[model samples]
Structure formats: structure tokens, C-alpha cells
Target: MTPPPGWYRDPKAPHLERWWDGTAWTEHRRTPEVTAPVPVAGASGRAKAVAVTTAAVVLVAAIVTGAVVLGQGDEEGAEIETAPTYYTQAPTTEPPSPTPTQSEPSADDPAVVTDELNGITLPLLDGWVRPKYVAEDDVVMTTDGTYDCPADGGVCRHGLVMSRTVTSNDERSPEALAKEDIKEAAESAYDRDTIGRRPYGGMESHEVVKSGPVAVAGRAGWFVRWRVTTAEGPGGYVQSTVFPSRVGTESPVCVRYVFDAGADGPPLADMDRITKGIRSVDDPDGGGGVGSSVGPGEG
Candidate 1:
């Protein structure tokens, strides 16, 4: 038979009563009720108030307990809405090592070469081979490569030269001397007739690339750069500088570099250092002031 919708003695626990809503047992439960407290004589009001307050507190506690029990009971029979969580670890990776690259030669670390005969010292391009001083001429250093002129058909050895002379009583400046040399070279090898239009040697053409004032041996000087034609290739020419001695004794000095027309020549910056480093010294031993000078022809 169906249970009535009211509180009934619990079959599982004899000391407690549970709610039966016709077909199902509810979460609500209660213990057997004890006899009510009787008011003492002349204190009925206080006693009744105390009894009412205790009942109210018990009722609230029962309601909270029922709610908790209800939640637990439902959890046992109901399907949970939460999904099962899963995690996957990612693979650790590292960046590739940087590729190795070649480092450029430092510009500040210069090469030094000296002319012992003229008592002159100058900086040279790094890796420059000291020349053999093959002739009485002013060759101090030379390149390893030799040029077979495509047009002229002979080897034009390329190198650096140092020329020095003590100035006499002439008051003319170094700039004037360099200008005079240029004029002389133009008139001697290059014809004054056709002049600026014709190509020379194997060079495609020539140009007065640069001209400026420079200082050498603590005295005023001039710097000149000339680009000339090679035989069906690049042109080569002489770069000369004129420096008047600072001792005031009128000593004119010159340092000239003759570069063969080619792509393999030392860069302009190195040439500039070479020229700027030229200074007069009192020693023919190729002194260590500029750096230890290698014995003649020693690189």
C-alpha cells in the first residue's frame, strides 16, 4: 500500500520520524518529541518565552541540516554535469644556434713600415708585404700580385715609395712642389696637345681624383690622389705628398705611392693612414717609434 503524505516512523531508524510523500521518502527527518516544559508558579511568562525561543532555533537548525542532506542524497543518484578534465604537455624546443660569420679586419690596428735610408716612418695597410728594395728607387713595400699589362704586355710592379730631400733656401711651400710635379708628369708622358681627352696605357681614362692640404713631419704639406688608366683594365698612377721640414731650416720632403691600376689595390682609407703617418726621423735603423720596423724586406 502507498504511504500517506505525512510524517511516519522510519523503518530504518526506530528513534526518528521521516517524511513520506505518498511514494517517496524525503530528506526531512525529526527525533521523537519530548514533553513541553511547564511554567513555574509566578514565572509563566518568562518560561513560555524561553521555550518559544529554543523551538525557533531548533527549527532553523533542522532546516539547514535537511538542505545539506538533500544535496548529498541527490548527488548519490543524479548524473554530475561536470566533464572529466584531461591535460597534454607540449614539447620543449630551443632556437637554432646562430651561424658563424667572418669578422672584418680592424681599421684602427694599422701596419707600420719604415724607410731606413731616408730615416722616414709611416703606417701601411695591414698584411702589406715589405718590399725587397730591388732598385735604388724609393720602394718600401710591394703587393704580392704582379700585373701583366693586357695592353702594354709587361709586368707593372705596384708598390709604395718614400722620397726625401732637405729644403734649401727656397721658401716655396710643399703644395707648390706637388703642383709642379703634376704639371711635369702631364707634359712629359701625356701630350699637352690633345690633353684631357685621350686615354693612356691600359686604363680606360684618368682623373685628378683628390687634392688637399696635409701635414707631415710636423710641417705643412699637400696630398694628391691620381686615378689613371690600366692597359684595357684599371689605371695606376703616383700619389705624392710634399712636406716642408718644421725645423725652419727649409727641408722639403716627399713621400710618393705608386699603385698599379687594378681591383686588388689597398683601400683609400689605408692609403690615407700611410700618408698621414709619414714623419722624418734621425735614425737609419728603421726605428721602433712607429712600431718595430722589420728588417728591410721583412713583413
Candidate 2:
């Protein structure tokens, strides 16, 4: 026997309903009425409207529950990424780490060494270097860098120049100071350097090589030079040159030089040449290494 015409589960889509006529399935189909309200057989208009509203709310609840429960797993099924409410959380994260930094020095160039207290600049000769973190504050320049002292002590350099403003002494004459400082200059540069290495062993004896008037930075100056023989290595020369500064209280400024007499030394003529190259820092053509009048930090 065949069932009478009515709505029933659809053959093609089990979740939907279809209508059957007396003889065959009809084209009419709809969602299964799983959550639709059921009304009393005698319900009036207002009662039916209330029932419909109730069903809508229940239908929404069922749909949310289904999504939470049935939507769990991925290869199997993935959980619903969103919640029943409006707000959803953004993925958690952290910012990238910060980097560190440092600064490289620009002291490689053999630059002009300055005497700020005296308003003058010293010129660098070939093979000379104005190094960094190596010489003392009073040291303005040196030659051929440095090496292990033959004495097996500290380090040693073959040639050096130093400068200082004349203060703390009652006598201000350039000539007196130049003569007086020669012995001390020789002792400091050859007998023993700052680090206490006697690179020339020790000053065995010295004789005045020259004593005369000179000029420095456009000012009259006096200088005393000595030829020093050491107990070790080749002999060398030491000079103390002093002049009145062109700035400040016109205080005298003293410049000293020590040159190795070995084959590797700068020619003795370079001492006079360097003195001649001295110029006022304020001069238009003076103190130009690193392209400008740049002051170096204490070595």
C-alpha cells in the first residue's frame, strides 16, 4: 500500500522535507521543521504569533549550540574559530628585539697636530702618524709607530715630538727655557720613554749640536740641539725649541723633538723643515687634515 499525500523526509537530502502527491513526489521542498513551534489545534492569531517568536529564539540557540559542539576537529573537523558573541580575539604576538651600536675612529690620517693654548699648528712629515689611544696628552706626534723595546720592557718609538705651554715658572725668556729643557728632553725621549723603556739603553753622553735663534708660528724663538750617544742602538739628537705664544698672556711655548740617528730615522733636515711649517691655527691655509681644523682626543 502507498501512503497518502503529505510532507515527509526528502530522499535526496535527508535534512530537508518534500511533499508527495497522491501518485509521486512533488517539486516542493523545505528545511526540516525540527525547531518550528507546534500550535494547539484551536489557537487564535495572537497565540500563533507568540509561538512563532518563541520558535525563532529557540532556533538561534540550537544553531549556536550546533556550531560549538559539531564544529570541533579539522582533518576530522575544525573547531569554530569564532565565539557565540560579537567580539573575537586577535592572535597574540611580540615585537622584534632591538639592535646594539658602536663608533669607529677617524684617526688613521696623519693630521695636523694643534697647540690650542698657543694658537698654533704643527705639520706632519712623511712617515709620521698622529695616532690615537697611544701617546700621552702632552705628546703631539711620533714617527714609524711603535714596537717591542729591545730591553724586553714596554714599547718604543724611534722618534717623537711634544709641546707644552710655559707656566708655573718665574723665568719667561724663550732662550733660558730652551737651554734649560734640553737635558730633561733628552732624558725623557731617549734615557726612558713614558712607559719606562730605555730604547736607546740610556743617555751615555750628549753634546750641544746647535744653539741659535729661530722662528715658530711667525714669532721669534730660541732653540738648543744636542747629539746624544746611548749605551745601546744608534745615537740620536734632541732639540728644545721655545717661543712666545701668539695667544693668551703671550706665554712662552716649548716644543721638543727626539730623532733616531739610525738608518730608519727621519733626515736631520726634517727638524728645521717642520719648524718652518708651523703656522697660526687661525691662518686660512693652516691645520688642514681630515679636511678641517679637527681636534683629536687625548691618546
Candidate 3:
């Protein structure tokens, strides 16, 4: 009888195994085929062990890849967070306001007047010179240059007269000049031979009066009067103080003149004319004259 065409083995229990197909057994085996014992019970356990080892290797590989991806994500996030941002703001402003103007004096001002003396002309009689006298130093003298009244009138009514010297360049300010003149007048008492010096003859009292704001030589000046007691003489004593209109290192010069009040009479009436004629040369728009050009230097 013929056997099946697929692989077949001998049915008899033998140490050798043989393959047969259809009607014939193959003679291909040069050596006998050895058969292993059948492992009936442990076959499933071996298959399970192999499956567990393969699963463990796959899990380890997946874990390593997930760790690398997570590390990359963290690095990228840090870089983004550290970057800088840009921004801006607005500008400020301010507001505005107005301005004002100024004014000056006019020709109609009443204090103005004019005079001429020794070929010098000036505006006179504003709030300029003050009248006062110094009682010390040299005796001053005067002759009227011109007057509102005639010279023959023994009364000597309306002209002004005075005497003084430019003592020192140190006397610059008006106050300093005044004080120096006064000190000089007091010392003049020692010079008895001088014209206004007379011994006081037991007179009970003395007096002095001053007037000014006169213009002389284009500048402001003052007038002064003094009445003093005589140590030995008879009539009331009188003296005059005249200051130069221009101020200088040697200027605004002071003059002291002793007069016979008995001869020139009281000086009040004449003082009015002197004060009225006083004037100031307007200061030049830029600056004025030779004095302005000259700077201070040793005398």
C-alpha cells in the first residue's frame, strides 16, 4: 500500500528516524538520523522566557529615547525664557508768557536851569549840589563874576562868590570832600594873618546855613554859609563854601571863603541865585569826556 506524499516517519519505535513519501522510502541518508526525546511538559515555559527578554529590551530602548526628547524640550524652553523684550515712552512739553517796557525823563522838568562861568557853561539848579561850609584850614575869597543886581549897590544883592583850593586827590566822594574842607577850616584858626581870621570878641552865639543843587562847569555844585563868634572883633562872622560841579580825582573841589557879613551882608539872597544857576551836563550816551578816558593812577 502507498503512504501519503507529505513527510512521514517510521511508526516503529527506533533509535533511528526515517522519512518516506508516497510509495518509497528515501535512501538519501548516508548516516542514521538520531531522534531526540520528546519534551512534553516544559515547552510553553521556554517560549514565555524568550518573549519576556524581547519585551525588556524594547522597553529599555523606549525609555532612553523618551529621556533624550524630554532633555531637548527643557533646553529649548530655557533659551526662550532668557531672551530680552523691547519697549518705549512719550516726551514732555512747556508753556509761554509775556514781557514789559521802560520810560525816561522829559525837558519840562522844573528843576532844570543853566549858567556860565570862567568860559564854562552848564545846566544848573536841579536836585544837585547842597550848600554847607568847612570851618578849618585856609581862608577862601570871592568876587562876583556876574549877578542879577548891579555891583555898585553896596548892599551886594544878587551874585554869588566863594573861595577854595583843590587840596588833595584823596578827596574823591562828596562826603569825604566836605569833611576834609571842614577839618581844614578848623585848622585855619592858627593862621591869624589870613583874611577871614579875626579874634572872637566875646560874642554869645554863632550860626550857619547852606543851599545848593547848583550847576557849575557843566556839573552839580553846592553853596555853604557860616556865622561864627569873634574872639576879639565887632561884627557878626560869615563864611562861604563852594564846591566844583565836576567830580574828579581832584574834582568836585571845595572852596571856603570868609566874608565880612558886614561887607557882603547876609548870604541868603545871593545863595538863591547860585543854587538856581547850578546844572549837570547830561552824562554822554556812551560815556563822557577826558575824565572818562583817564583811569586812576598815582598823582
The sequence of per-residue lDDT tens digits that candidate 2 reaches over residues 109-204 is 344666565577787788877655555546677786776655536666777777777675878888999998998888987787676767667889
Q: Which model is ahead, 1 or 2, in terms of lDDT?
A: 2
Please report, as a residue range, the 10-residue window in candidate 1 with the lowest summed lDDT: 80-89
Give model 1's clash tally.
Answer: 11
C-alpha lDDT score of every prediction, in listed order:
0.55, 0.71, 0.35
Q: How are the candidates ranked when ordered by lDDT, highest leading?
A: 2, 1, 3
Ranking by TM-score, best first?
A: 2, 1, 3
Maximum-lDDT candidate: 2
Supply the TM-score for candidate 2.
0.58
TM-score of 3: 0.32
Name the runs in model 2 displaced over 4 angstroms. Answer: 1-111, 135-137, 195-197, 285-297
Choose the strongest candidate by TM-score: 2
lDDT of 1 by residue, 184-238 (tens): 3433222221223223342344579889898675667896777765435554666
Q: Estimate each model's TM-score.
A: 0.47, 0.58, 0.32
* TM-score of candidate 1 to 2 decimals: 0.47
Q: How far is candidate 2 from the true structure (C-alpha RMSD, Å)?
A: 20.2
